[model samples]
Target: MTIQTNICPRCGKPTEEGLCPQCRAADTKLLACEPRVTAVYCPVCDSQKRGKTWSDLRMPREDLIAELAVSAVSIHEDAKNLKVAVRSEDTASNRTACTVEVEGTLYSVPVSETCEVEILWQKEACDRCSRISGGYYEGIVQVRATDRKINAYEREVAASIAEQAEESLQQSGDRLSFISELEDSKDGVDITVGSQHLGQEIARMVTGALGGRYTTHPKLVGEKDGKALYRVTYSIRLPFYQKGDVVVSRGGYFEVREIDGRRLRVFDLQTGATRTLAETEVERLLGNVRDAESALVVFTQPNMVGLMDPKTYRTRELSAVPWTFPVEGQPIRVLRDEEQDRLVIVG
Candidate 1:
């Protein structure tokens, strides 16, 4: 087989290099220079524009390097299987310089190039952050207790619910999903949300978990482009009696076991039966047993038991169910119903 070659113009010789070895070497040296790119980012938000949408600033440093690496280098159309890598990084006072290496095949020839890219960050507030600083709010959620003052534990729970809801909604691309402010008041908790939909969502979630009822009221706040705009107020009312509280309603003594929506599951002290009561029926709360001590069970009977009260240190006969009897000398819960003038044995 005869080897094919090209005639060099300057050297006047048949050679495979075409332009001769000297010219070919010079061309290769010129081709191995560098790439070209310009990367811009927001200094305030630390976010970069990826297509039309902005990327999350919370991404790690390595992820940012990988993202900028591809778009920073300009590859020729003849190059195939192009790959980019970050070789080194230099961080200055306000700007960051990254040496990006690009490797690919140009016309079936392996070639590599590196370029230094400076990430220029400009100061600008993102849409969400700007709106938040502008005190933009679409709705207010007011948390209150029904026929009682809000407790600290319940207030904390409501606040946590609002925070979790805001985070979840923000991740779903709702840029306006945020809690602008959380205020603890005598009534309960007030959460200011960036969107009326988010306010309602958080209110519902808190009420569902803590057993309460909520209602929405719209108020005309302003006008936008000849259209009237209204802000919503979500009023959430928690249950009057929480679990483990002794309450009296309609001349009946009962202990609240569970609360669901506007209804409550309670155990009747008189009949030793479990039943549910509507919110409207729970007229008033007589008292709350913050704590109860185990009393000494002196005598055990089928229908009644004699218990020595821990507070009073006196033996009292309290009614008990046939199956709910405590053993003699064992401890039992003896609750005193001051209004009913009787002792309740809740074992």
Candidate 2:
């Protein structure tokens, strides 16, 4: 005798696919979901977020979502913790589950399928107190993104920080080098030198008689005490240029011996020796720029914007919003129709 079987017309299954018998009467639920390959977004700026779902990329939709019971989490594997990795270039959140933003749009980067190392760029997100409006990046907030690997990110960060350190020391060196033309220090503690060329200022100073920027393959940690009580020897990293050019003039030249407010020194090409100069004299000659200053923008006060003049060292205020960002649902007193949709940081 031949056996017969009964199956649901909808699913064409006698059983295992979860058809017929006890499963047809449930409510029909619909949601917005689609399989995406490359997704990028930051949750802090997302209008809405997708609820947690099982990350089974390869599964039949119906069979993939058959919930026996509504539970907190439904992953089949309980012991395997997901691993996430991010690269140095990526400065956004480095999480197994992330709220990442890329170029001001919201999408989730599926880290489960992502790699051991990924190359990403720095975009908008460090300052959190802001919003996204229309297509333009409407808010002025900053955030940091980073990778999962500890060492690579550390190296990148270290390079940047080291650059900043070099630049700062150069600025100080410029001032001291100028003073070396006039007065020398007494304790040698007042003068300072730099380990490498952080920027043009240091290069110009150190290249003294053989003037201009020089690129010396610097050791990672620079040198210490050869002239001043706190003499410095530092490793320098530069561009394609090797052994940065040095210049000589009628009066003298300069080279870095140490970098310390506690102590300082500058080289005199004419004297062909290191000298101790007052930090004050260094300022009068080379230009004493504050460490917080930027090569691009000058500031009258902290948080104020504007490009300050390099010569006079004077600053003017940057533009300000005549009308600030509007409060959602609040009435905006219209002073002028011209200012509508203008730039203001609204909440």
Candidate 3:
């Protein structure tokens, strides 16, 4: 009887099928790396660009370098237990040299390879920064007060809200939603935004926090890509009576706690009760609590309290409410009611 034994055709070694593991592993390339790769980034914002899309860099510089280096390397399909390591150094201001080492098993034989890849750094403005530089804006948010100019406090709040909205949108990957300019006009604050979505967000947030409403106006600018482009204006109108205002309503002193449409939520300074009143019921605005003067309590009684006025340095008598207690030595908040020639205890 005659028997046939299998042997590797090229290596002359014993094998189960065609070629031995060592021979096959030696014939295949374990790792292949590109000679050079290009990395695009925004100079102003440090955003990374992958192909045609730009994104904020969320990784450290070293990690980014390692990632870019590994991306330039390709391993053989049959390799198993693959492991890769990268080391990089800055060769120039715009060039990075990287060494990529890979280890794995191919055809049941261990193999390894190391190669060099050069990274060519390129700079390009990101979408948001480009729009800002080119003065491109799709909407304007005008923050104004009803029947008056916006106060300094309102201007500060509006500007802060606009910036916060821009930051939040950009962090959530809305790259085109940016604030191009924040200007303080004679009437109010003007926020120029790169997208109408950002304008709407700022307007909504401002009105929600400060108590008001907004209206939108759209004007046709031109056409792009067979689509009509319109620039929007978000007109935000703050209420006439803002929070913290001391007002006279129905022969009583009340503090404006909130403004809702044509009504005002008031806190009665004399009775220490909270109630709602129509805007037309308010007789006059004394002053905002923010401008209230601090007075020292000279004496306290059941129905009346004596205070040393800050403006005149003279003792004045005012009625106290049950909501707040007056300490004989501590200073208390008081608003001057010029119409009644008396001090109103606010808190």
Each model's lDDT: 0.74, 0.27, 0.91
Deviation of model 3 at 214, angstroms: 1.5
- Per-residue accuracy of model 1 over 1-347 as CA lDDT, tens digit each: 24565777776567675676544433552123224334445565576555556555477777766566555655566667777777545575545667777776654566777767666544566666777889988899999998789887788889999999988887777767888899998888999999987998898899777777899999998999999898899999887777677777797777788898677798886677899988688766654444555789899777778888787888888767643758899897656666565666555
Candidate 3 local Cα displacement, residue 328, angstroms: 6.2
Top lDDT model: 3
RMSD per prediction, one decimal? Answer: 6.1, 24.9, 3.5
Better of 2 and 3 by lDDT: 3
Candidate 3 segments exceeding 4 Å error: 1-28, 77-83, 103-112, 293-318, 325-332, 338-341
Q: Pick the candidate with the highest TM-score.
A: 3
Give the lowest summed-lDDT range of ten residues in model 1.
29-38
Candidate 1: segments with Cα more than 4 A from true spot: 2-52, 55-57, 76-83, 104-108, 243-263, 267-274, 278-347
What would the per-residue lDDT of candidate 3 be over residues 179-223, giving only the tens digit for each residue?
A: 888999999999999999999999999999888999999999999
Q: Per-residue lDDT for 48-115 in model 2, tens only?
A: 11142212123342222222011112222321333322222324443222121112111121212221
